[model samples]
Target chain A: MTLPIETPAVLVDLDIARRNVLAFQAYADRHGIRVRPHIKTHKLPQMAELQLDAGAIGITCQKVTEAEAMVDGGARIKDVLITYNLLGEQKLARLARLNERVTVSVVADNATVVDGLAAFFADAGKPLTVLVECNTGADRCGVGIPSEAARLARRIAEAPGLRFGGLMTYPPADGAARVQAFMSDAKRLIEAEGLEVPCITSGGTPGMMQAAEAPIASEHRPGTYIYNDRSLVARGVASWEDCALTVLATVVSVPSENRAIIDAGSKVLTSDLLGLTGYGHVLGRDDIRIDQLSEEHGRLVSDGQIGLQVGELVRIVPNHACVVTNMVDAVHVIEGGAPKGTWPVVARGRVL
Target chain B: MTLPIETPAVLVDLDIARRNVLAFQAYADRHGIRVRPHIKTHKLPQMAELQLDAGAIGITCQKVTEAEAMVDGGARIKDVLITYNLLGEQKLARLARLNERVTVSVVADNATVVDGLAAFFADAGKPLTVLVECNTGADRCGVGIPSEAARLARRIAEAPGLRFGGLMTYPPADGAARVQAFMSDAKRLIEAEGLEVPCITSGGTPGMMQAAEAPIASEHRPGTYIYNDRSLVARGVASWEDCALTVLATVVSVPSENRAIIDAGSKVLTSDLLGLTGYGHVLGRDDIRIDQLSEEHGRLVSDGQIGLQVGELVRIVPNHACVVTNMVDAVHVIEGGAPKGTWPVVARGRVL
Candidate 1:
């Protein structure tokens, strides 16, 4: 059945998604770099298949649960790289089991994590690929310098049942140059020790467009490009039309001349303000700013005093698409304002 | 199987939840009012049952999808009041269909919405109970002032195939004084017009705590009290341990002496900064602040320069519990640092 443009439904523009995949893939191909588009943004196997069809080498997932959901949902990619550092006994065992299903690789910045991974893989009788994560000044994860990265890579190579796959880094915002320099220095230092530096993966959506020009990196993993959001548009990476996903909302109450409340709130659009003042961007109405969001209500205030009648439908492009994807059960694909199909957010809440 | 106290797992303290339910129920009972604790906070049928067991008249849900999930999951309460205004043909039909299985009441502030509800109930040969939502100053989903509320209430009462239950208001932050005055004035106006008002629902966690002392509202529908969050703690309605839910996250990387990255970022703890500066309250360390959050990494900085080692577990009480609840798949119940059974966030992401 065709669902109405309800107040809190997630809308996906499939055409835009397809174009984004092709565009990113073309940029990677031109720079002789493999594009491993991260599935954490859309988390849909159909989108993954489209990326593969457009010449993506593999896919990147943030969690083991997400990777398992993607693989089970018929993503035919042979290689899946988990960009996050895996720790703990349970997570390591899950990682080893995932390695049996696909060519799985994970990142590590410490010897303890490497040791835990080595111990798990050795007992599981499986070979696990490890990448030394170098901190490119994001200050979130990874080792401090290229020397620390090389040392960690050496440890992974020496550890039983673990193979050093190379270096991975999620750079600071718009830090393409820093990533290039760090990866180059780290690759040289690793090879100086006569170690095989096979792959250098640098990723982040903000840097994805500029990643192709970075000659040191062999692969790029960009998650947000597939479903560009308000933050991406503000960053000048993509336009509103380039946004593949939007929250379809309706004006439930137009109590005043300048104020209206929408059914879509933080529960649907998410609380990822992304430095944007409003909860979500109202399509075609730049005059209106979503002033506040309660649990189930989005309060819109218009400085220009636009009159919105109750029951009027509106579209909101969220500030962050990945977080919004995790806030819903199913996302509706729209073509010419009509429903195409619904895709379940299978990895909606796989935060583990 | 035992789940570890990992970083970024939703931890529910059952004892606190039970106490919160009984406290709210007692407030309502003492005031000669009906308590309909909104289940959108916990999203667990077990907790809803606790509220009902503690003398709650029924339960309130923000969406029809939540009501459906609650009713199907063994909530035998006869009346399920959907506190949000219903819009669109699809949702009205769903509302009508819900009346077939359970008692469903909706809120509306517009004539068009009342007509839509009337049409659906007329076709179903049943009367749909509706509360005229009033804007007591929240400026969210309600009619403005007493005159508009009475007018809307009158319209709903006179509408064919619709029964006007009474008035509903989601109050602003100030508290019971404003809501009491508005409700009393609106009730007087509506009753003077020869209309019987059966239900008068007032909303807000902090406001509900003072509801028993006030004489305005006949029913209270506080959603967040079921899983008190950082906002409630800040409002002085709940203490730290009174917070029933928290995101148990692990420190994934200690990038610097002052900064550590957690596995739970905007995706898990959510970007619901609320009025607070940080995303959440760090359980053990008030000195440390979650300075920023990317999609998958929470960057925590400490003023005391204390470092979080890798693999260390920490609990974060999110600024808003309802938003965090929607972000996870299951909540791990914990008592005295020991693991309990996992309960699915059953009605989570039911944003229809």
Candidate 2:
């Protein structure tokens, strides 16, 4: 099926996306660390398969709905780990159901959450894995100290139908050393009590670049490597050519000589500014800035040097690719400027 | 279905939502104006039905997929108007098909777009209503002056299988008076040439509060009023109580005495910012500031007076309601602190 070169459509360069997957897997291989790419970035089973085929140990997801979507879309059992605190009856029920299908492990900082997971799994007659998430530095979700991490892990092991799955942490951006130290200390404290340490998962895209140097972590979970974006480019992790996703938009209205409006806007590109001024980077013109984006139009402010006419087509690399993927119904796959096919963002709004 | 008091789930106060619909419809009724509530706000057929039942002339959508979703979900025929420029073969084919089910009209600012629609309808053996969109000052999509507007309208009228509907303009935030003048001039110019003007549509929630005073427009398309947001409140168009939608989030991490983190971050709340200093307004706590938002965590800086512990629930009024609605899978209908039901944001990611 041929797609119109319209604004706001997520365009995936399959070649670049595959290369991104391979690069990360190779990095993990070189360091003897297991790779667990987070599926939250693409939210597609095919991408997950690519990672798994490239030697990923498993995948991590932020929401149960995302995990469910992935498993239902053909992800293997005993490979998906959810990195969110499980709360409430509805989510716990879903979590219990998910445990029946896979080796589902969840993170928790407080004993209350561990008890809740224990009650859920015990009632469901299933054994659930619990990871004591330590706040190495991010301070988002995790226990503060090694003693607290040990206490949470001990509570999980003591709770019925729960098994201690070792330590997990989403460290700060510059936290490779911190994660290494915390993991080493927490493991020693837990092992000193003669308990088993089955896993040590610590990863995020920003921290993953330095994670290979951290000897304590057995596995890494990097989500954004599958589709590098402008944020990654800014951080020197990836380049423009490495960005696998771009929004295909049409120049709808050229109101003035300097300003032209594209059909793609905040709804498709997303307002995930990611600290970058302007919405996204124009594909070919470094001089042109997507100055503003309304609901359905992206205003492009161009330097006078590059002359752009009305009704012309332009590709924009969004600041954040994962959020952009969530904002669209379907993404068009293209190879060398020719449309290949369109894939529906099946789990586009699975925000439970 | 019992839902936990999470901090970041989109909450639609059914009473206030219905009231906003009724109030907007009442204003249209008193002025002898047609009110077409934009479905891009809530993206639910049920909400659109409530507006129609309360005397809405029709509904306005931003994309072909949105219109398709609404019509498939039981929106009335001969009433839905798509206020976007239709381009490309795939979208034009959908537009031609949509004309069979509804009174579908599109706005175009350029002759190329007008010609594209005309060719598609001509090939389909149908006549489509085309509105010449005038850029009264939004600088988004539309012709700049009345002469360009008349030129586009004349081209549409002269083209085969296309009928010139009327003039449409999405005015700037403070350009209600400018829209009145521009539309009046365009209408007079077209009438002087013995042309028929069927409709004059002016839109924008900020300008819609004063739309009745603008005599040139026969209809108004205000999107955000169905769920007033912090931007509307900041603009003095609506009050805090008048806001029908909010994000119910959970305080998952109280890292420090002055810092708290919630589960709803940029991914759920969106990063529209819209020139606001913070992400959203924490209801009943003007002292707390949403300092930053990562993809899945909202960091709140408290002013020490308000003591908030972990696992506490809070309601956040989003900076922009429409963008936030597009981020979620479903919205909870809350009445007096209890969830009446959950409505799937069926058209949440319909950005074709």
Candidate 3:
């Protein structure tokens, strides 16, 4: 049952992954809401299909390329929501092509994105759906206030070949209250303008379970919940066992009594510590600290109490599973501790 | 003519890159020593060939796949030294195949690696050359002391189908004194054992100029010298103008008066800070601080003086050029500020 794969390879416990898919669907089903798992987590069409089988509304992507990957990679999902500001001639054309494929919608915080998108889709037969991105608390992309969202929504509704698809917000972790307050005001303003607010999508894995706390949102988008990471575990949103993705690395070099090097470095495990102290958590070894990572080598400093032999396989729980997933070209999927097959990370490096 | 490459793409200044290669080669030639540029920095066959054109003796790779990449990707290198301890039957067979393609040598610090390699190459007609790696000051890999290296060298010499190829050490930056002392002792021990000591390779870009001061070394391997980064700039090993690699990202969202979001996030620019405070240095915008990064978003908080607008292209000098090169599949090569062609990062993600 041992995986006959190379070192520094990613392994996904598919049973656990399926369980994660079902568990999130159960959570959403309990709250009488729809679950739309973000495809950015695994970036594989297979995972997206599994989420769809578990009753997800659609797949969520952060960029046009990501959405294109899900559709073309054989996810077979009919609905897609791109949760980023799409701009430029190149991306807008890609967005139009994507919208032609499925019921596609995108979020925009500024008028520039809206104008660019409108210019391309203005001649389309079916109107494009555009969501007004509201800044609940992430402070990255989105409108600052409810009025801004209302104004953007009106602009989308008035633009040719575009429809107002309601509001969307990517709030910070533990900011469900702020989302509730902001989304409620934006929704009220949009409804007062005699426009139908079809969907309000709010997202964040840390605040996933409490997404229903913002009762105004119709659907939720949580990317990392399908894989879960050190950040999610630290926030008590998920336990270590709930994590389906793990990097199976080998002890390549033991430099000293206190230091050992693994084949998984920044290229594999990644430097996204997610505000955690160490690079990753080594399963079954609490004393080993993954203190540093070079491009192709991860240096682990041990407590010197337990000796690790060279060539021993160690499973590592990375700080952020989403970023780790993007680092690799494929993952070796397993079921019941037996190697099943390799799953292509089909959408990896599709940052365009 | 400007490059038609999309935003958030990697750009390589070929003129500066060629200058870096020639300058390092000239230094090695002046010292009457051989220069082997580590392909781990650029990872492209074109780049490796460029180094060869600049008068490098050979190439250095951290993994067998990289060697395979250089040889198969048309670098046409005759000699390659893999500075990693090759393990497992799969990698060994691959290494043998690589050796059949070109002259291949590897490094080993412990008897386990030596024994494993010996077992794999025991029946081969041509003996595989292996170097005893010594840890002078950098506590990452290699044997601890001169005796350990000497013992390993003796083991390599006695093993069937293997040759003791002197010593190699990836010393700490500015540790010429330590490398000299340890290599001197190791060389004396190996020579006393009646084995021909062929090479003594020391490596580190930060200590490139001072490596010649360690008279015990025969050759030097410095990868980052070709594409210097913010780390080399901070350490005074390279100037700002010497940096040849940059990530061209567009300001996607200006969240506030002092905040901007760029398309180059951890996925493109990476999260390898290398002890630097910020992620990267934006060219001509010291007022902008690339304070944080998400998967597809780089959050920049400014001093509110120089305003950054959406769609404006900003070139960023990353913290570590080596890791940045690994993140992209291809880089846009430029000459004299005009668009050249794109160079495929052929060896990228070859962590195995």
Candidate 4:
């Protein structure tokens, strides 16, 4: 049988995506925390608009170019929070232009990044909002201690053409308690120095459901909920039904009785295992494990008869959704199991 | 203290790339083997032209759309080989269209893919070349044994509008003996069936230096030879000086004395570890290790003082060059440490 679309295509179930967006928005609403969804997951302007319409406070981006693409794609995005340390003239100048287009805020863990931001936006009519990124145990980026968080907050507040917005942390899995403890102490310390912490944001798809446990956080940013993947499912943060983005691939070769090769490989599904074993989870085929991947082929193997044929189509929930979305230029949109059309991943490859 | 290009940029050193291309071409020339360089590494038309100018027979692509991009990018590419088991009507239709531009050939391990190619090109003026993909050692794709390879070759030879070209295999590392053994058996079997084995191709960057060992192979396809990466260096196939592609990223945050975060992450460097330990090798900083990566940040850590200051530019040779080439939209070209212009990754995101 002919497939609905081409093989090895990223298929975003719009109905499921909308449901996921609204479900997370309602969860945050119930917790009395704002939802500032990260656009790195979908990267499509229409998906960002859907989140905004579903009661998101604004949108969160990782780079200036991502924010530029989102706003340039004609999304009604008026506010953007770039949750990365802005450095260099090229990035800062682009951030300044994006600031002119929308109310933009950024995060910084050191005085160097804060100084660059201040120097670039020194003469702007509106000061750029800056957040102190605190390390609540992720050990990725951010201040290691609450005292350092307060110190950076003080630096951002003292810098010209910058307003200290609050604190932000990309917390570890189940790290709501750590985020609360770290940000609470930092907030108390910054308040003692006569500065107000306007907003405290904590983000992670793994700890998204526990966002309310951190009562000090004014907002939470979760990027993977709209298109949950096998990683989230493995963490019990999302179920298979919640997965909206899947790679629809064709079996190009059944090399063995136990092995069938699909067209989606590292180029499409990506090599982001996210701590999972296999490349992806084939829907309705738990017996089949996507064992390996080359640039353009995914190897599916089973213990018994594989029961797959060449030209057979399979929808796979990749191990990580965000990276897969970034790998594709566009996604074929599906609603209620029927192909609707396609949505250009407007913010894809905007890594500048 | 300004970087020549933006942070998190893929920089291709033209001097090193040209040297690598010519070095490989010279190696293949001594072996009297044709060089069909895979375009997946640099994905640049100019790089393809350089390869062809270095006496390469043609270029190899993993996808039909990638072939389309390379040919459309104004490269003087007259011949192409897509080393993939392409199935379905859409891909075959596009492959048919690509055939109109250049002499295109494909590989298949099953009758399904062969029938699709035959049905697509049955009414075409020129017949399409089909090679039977044999699984010598790497069990990714292809027929498992020589008998299966000969059977598929006979099928392709008898198929209308298709010409049985030869045998092709993506061999395992250090599998030159295996390639010769399998291809020699398959050639004898196919010849007994009154079919001529015009070409027997084997490919792997790890085995590129040993291409001459497999005397039965007529040509070798190596993608990562042009832009050697950390994996190639680890395999002892290429040295650090031979690496052409490096990610020029800035240290955006110094979270601690032992830790620094770069702007390049999995989105820029990719998550294809290729069985290596760290994400990449940071040049000029042997003491530092890139221990972790998020979508937009790479965590560099050292046992002692990292010494990497914020805003410092560092060049990293990623674990895999081919996947890193697909992450960015364009790469900045550098010659002898000076910045040239940029080249769009013409075949990037063309998974279809």
All candidates: DockQ: 0.69, 0.51, 0.77, 0.87
Model 4, A1-352: lDDT tens digits are: 2346787888899999999999889999998999999999999889999999999989999999999999998559999999999888788888888888888999999888888888877798789999999999899889899899889888888888999999999988879999888888999999999999999999977888889999999999999999999998998878899999998899988888999999999999888887899999999999999988988989999999999999888989999999999998789998877778888899998888
lDDT of 1 at B349: 79
Candidates' C-alpha lDDT: 0.83, 0.83, 0.87, 0.90
Model 1 ranges off by over 4 Å: A1-7, A335-338, B1-7, B335-338
Real A-B contacts recovered, model 1: 0.73
Clashing pairs in 4: none
Kindly list the per-residue Cα lDDT of model 4 for residues B134-234, writing each as its tens digit. Answer: 89888889899999998989889888899999989999988999999999999999999888999999998898989999999999998899999999999
Model 4 alpha-carbon drift over 4 Å, by segment: A1-3, B1-3
Q: Could you give the DockQ of candidate 2? A: 0.51
Q: How close is candidate 3 to the true structure, as a TM-score?
A: 0.98
Residue A13 miss distance in model 1 (angstroms): 1.6
lDDT at A86, model 1: 83
Interface RMSD of each: 1.6, 2.3, 1.1, 0.9
Give one digit per residue, the lDDT tens place, for model 1 in B218-303: 88888888889998899887899889888878888886788888898887787877688888989879998888987788889987
Question: Which candidate tops DockQ?
Answer: 4
Model 2, residue A25: distance off in Å is 1.8
Q: Model 2 over residues A211-313: C-alpha lDDT tens digits?
A: 8767899999998888889988998888999999988888777777788888889888887777788889998899899888887778898777436655577
Residue by residue across A1-352, what tens digits does model 3's lDDT show?
A: 2468888899889998999889879989999888888888899999999999999989899888888888998747889999888777888888888888899999888888888888989998778999988888888899999888888899999999899998888888788899899988888888899888999898878888888888888899988888887778887888899988899888877867788888888888889877889898888788988998877788888767437888888898899999888888889998888888988898888888
Q: Write the number of the candidate with greater lDDT, choosing between 2 and 3.
A: 3
